[model samples]
Target: MEVAEVQKQYIRELLIKGRKIEAIKYLRTNFDLTLRDAKRLAELIDEDIADDEYIKRPGPFSGGGVAILTIVFGLVGVIMLGVAIHLYTSNRSFVREAEQTVAIVVSNPSQPVFEYEINGQTYTYYSNVESDPPSYSMGEEVPIYVNPSNPNDVLINTFMDRWFLISLLGGMGVIFLGVSMLVFFAARAR
Candidate 1:
């Protein structure tokens, strides 16, 4: 290969790997190229790589659609779980009322953990299945229902936030249908 071409490749690779000193040394040794030229070449190569990679990735519209779908479906699961909890609480009375000033119960069906404390009492709780907290504090006030007939039998917290999960489920459904429609329409077009 030509001397200039060899120098350019070496400079480009070094800059991509962020080796400015080595690139400059080689540039000075092999080619009479200026420091500015070396820097410019490196920058151009890096930008070219960046631009190419960006083009290969999904665009904002389709990518954003997928993102929206993911969030929507996630929320759907959550909302459904909340609705189920609410129904169960209302029907079976899972929430507890304490004659004592402080009553502790698992945060609700919403949380996954070993225990949560309210007032003075500590309530032992867990998910229907074994799991750990999501690592972020996202739990809000969970509505709990208490049995009027019996005070001690409290643990009935209704999962009133069914809509949260519905959004997720609905989002997933929409995305799926959208993809399916796209495929169907494309097939017909062909």
Candidate 2:
């Protein structure tokens, strides 16, 4: 098939940007050419633009530094994912052995203080987490998880309280790994 003028221009641009593989794939898809033919045409376009003074082509190592940085970020993401998995498993076991109870917010300074009754005795608990708008208000009732053996060991039963950290770390890990893969592919194009 005879390549259109516009297609030729686009292929040349792709080659100049060090996307020869993409240019070849484009030809195979749009022009319905065989893989070998598409590769040959893309190489021809690359050679045609090799000496064009106005069009600057990327060096062989153009995105090498960015690829290396992304790899480091990906490694950090893997570590975060590992930590998240560990926290999730540990929290799951704790939840399974925990007992549920209703607690009232007694104070709301920086962290909310909760009061609950167990076995006809009153126990007071303080939230370790602090939020800007505050998760609880004074006089609000909330459900909590507690170790039956040790009433002092307690946790808020809300989903956010139980899984927020794990979710955040897992999300960040996936994003970093995805970005690393994209960067690595772009660098290889050079």
Candidate 3:
């Protein structure tokens, strides 16, 4: 496809701004060119404007900086995965020994407090997880698992209450790890 004058100007601007990848992507999408052709066109545009004093060229350590950042993200992903695993195992152990009972919501919506009876004694404890638009209304009855020896130790008998944090951390870890891998491979290919 023939490049329009406006497209060429935009490509030149992208190159001047050190956004070669974006320029290549624009050429691929707008011009219906193969990756190799788009990349070649972008590089040609970059060379055409190499002498322009306004261009902010990348420094020698730019690639190294990206590699270092990718490594840091990978490390964070590993740490998050580790914490998720620990929480999952700990929650599993707690649920194994906990007794089930129905508890009434006694406190405000944002910070729900549960009240339950064991034998002739009553116990009220704040839920560990709090939600906006409140998960439970006041006086609402919810099934919960409570430690027999310590009534204050409670877990709401719902997948979200017990597993939300684990799922969130694990999902973020996977995403970070996936992105890091893709960047690493792409850099290596270049």
Cα lDDT tens digits for candidate 1, 67-176: 56545654555565565556545543233333322223334333543344444345544434322543213343333333344443444233323233445544555565
Cα misplacement distance, residue 26 of candidate 3 (Å)? 27
Off by over 4 Å in 2: 1-64
Best of the candidates, lDDT: 3
Q: Candidate 2's residue-wise lDDT over 155-185, tens digit each?
A: 8888778889999998898888888777777
Write model 3 residue lDDT over 53-86, tens digit each, in one string: 4465554336588788789889888888988999
Error of 1 at 162 (Å): 2.4
Model 2 scores a C-alpha lDDT of 0.83
Off by over 4 Å in 1: 1-131, 134-141, 145-161
Q: Of the candidates numbered 1 and 2, which has the greater lDDT value?
A: 2
Tell me the RMSD of model 1 versus the true structure. 15.7
Worst 10 residues of 2 by lDDT: 52-61
